[model samples]
Target: INIIIQNQTMIAQMPHAADLNDVMSAIEAMRIQEESSYQCPDYLSKSEEDGSALPVNEECRRKMAEWCYQVVDYCKFSRETVAIAMSLIDRYLASNQGREALANRKLFQLAAMTSLYSAVKVHEPEAMEPKTIAGLSRGAYNEDQVTAMELEVLGAIGWRMNPPTPLAFVHHCLALLPDGSMSMSDREAILEIAKFQTELAVHDYSFVHIDASKIALAAV
Candidate 1:
């Protein structure tokens, strides 16, 4: 209850257009300046090279990603949450090399749920309970398992959950658009379309190797 109230308060206090413009401008500038440094290696392609050992193939990844999207939608979480969860899953798999434990179907499901749970905690003030997350997994994972995997994933990623997602870059680029290029309504319409495209990009395995900023621009 308190957490929900806090979230609502935060939303209510969001900055107006003028302040948002300034913040987005700064983000856009920083993104451009550090674009080269932000290149995440082709983790998906590398994972495929060791596919015989990893067990989780492209089809498995696609199913889990779809499940994550469904869970996020059912829970009314933002698309950003799903994107972050996908990012963590990819990074964890890539960083751990041939950890055969992830090959287990049950363990893989738990990892997916845990990644979503972690993203929720970071991106939502009022997070779903561990039991709720486990329930959504259709009993493949219990609350305790979900809790444990959450810690494991956090450690695996070295607690770096703040990767720059395509959505972030999209907003930054949208802010950088010329002021007189379009009316406010037109700009909002473009943002809506871009965001929808970004959501599609998030689940597609083909886009996994692409840079986030490039994906953002492409979506726009």
Candidate 2:
């Protein structure tokens, strides 16, 4: 009994690894589609409680966020890329009944990866040439891993790539906001905020189940 107590204490004192149940619950909360319209607030609360961990360490979060912004800025990707990716993942899962070819894994990563793959295909076709896509997920696992899974994703969802993105909306809204109203830096800041909203949408099934045309509007 004493030894067991010590072991439990040590485990608890160690860094908090992600709680699997909590993550799944959060994932469930983010799921947008339901046969029923009603949802349990308790379920969402529980997931939120579990998913409270910082996505990265404090110092790293800012750095990572900045890096992501730079990439977006450099690439000149419209916010639509993020929205399109989100919708693609949601559509793929609903179409497949949330089943990927590979079983026994979190649907979240698979969805994120697939959405990203689809976005790359449409938005950055030249940069995301077959070779590049293959390289991104290579060696980490069998090239066949993401490949087979991606194929399954494609099969589950028909080729419907032309989704409106938040960037499109941002442009539209900004244009109508009044010319010369905001500085370039201010415009980028607004865009950044929209991007964050897009990411939050990606986390839940809301992106998947919502209309693509409305995705940008909702996200922004």
Candidate 3:
């Protein structure tokens, strides 16, 4: 059964920025959540209700995480690319109830497809083709299902074609580093580090409130 959201109040306008107090609260929350003791809620945690469907289980989560990093390493995606992919997954999970349809694996396929789509749009717009996305979905899900998920993702994000992403912060931090004095190898190393840290941050919901800029800076 779908969880009923009660007394939902809709906001008409989006805030462009946070005030100083809001920023301090967000920073403190992030710090508190950064502790090693923190554990992520299982994507597939089951409810006590008799008919409730579980989200992705631990095994699936592990496999999904593995596949995500594989895509990053294989594609040689920049830190920003990895971050955008992750943001896509997190956003979908937050807003979509695909998990409730656990009799099938559509939601799992949706997650993978959306992550790939988001990454491509951000890092390699030239490389991303409609056919490519469709093909990826065709491999694991019905073309119609994938199309629906894509639409769902787009709508949930409010059709914002250019969302600010972690890579934006990563770039800003890199500029503050040595003036191109760093070796190519060092830069690549930083890229890998930033990407890994961004994925690790996904486990903490508090990380969501922290700007990607700070994460990139602290990672450096």
Query: Across residues 113-187, which tens digit of lDDT does each residue of candidate 2 receive?
Result: 555555555565222333333454454444445556566665655665544443444444444444467787886
Model 3, global lDDT: 0.51
Q: Find the candidate with the highest TM-score and give its number.
A: 1
User: Candidate 2 — what's its lDDT?
Assistant: 0.43
Off by over 4 Å in 1: 1-25, 28-40, 48-51
Q: Model 3 misses residue 67 by how many Å? A: 1.5
**Model 3 TM-score, 2 decimals:** 0.56
TM-score leaderboard ranking: 1, 3, 2
User: Candidate 1 — worst ten consecutive residues by lDDT sum?
Assistant: 4-13
Encode model 1's per-residue lDDT on 1-220: one tens digit a residue: 1121214312112223456667676566546633543334566566557664556666777788788888778878776888888877766765673254456666776787788887777776667778887778787778888787877777877777766777777776776665687898988888789888988887777777677778888989
**On residues 1-220, what C-alpha lDDT tens digit does candidate 3 reach at each position?**
0112232221111222335454445445444533311212233332324455655544454465566666656766443455455555545554445444343456665655666665555455234444555665557655555556666765654543233444444544454454467886887698678756766764344565466556666766
Candidate 1 residue pairs that clash: none
Clashes of each: 0, 4, 1
List runs of model 2 lying over 4 Å from the truth. 1-82, 100-103, 106-114, 129-141, 144-147, 180-188, 204-220
Q: Once all C-alphas are superposed, what RMSD does model 3 give against the true structure?
A: 10.4
Of 1 and 3, which scores higher on lDDT? 1
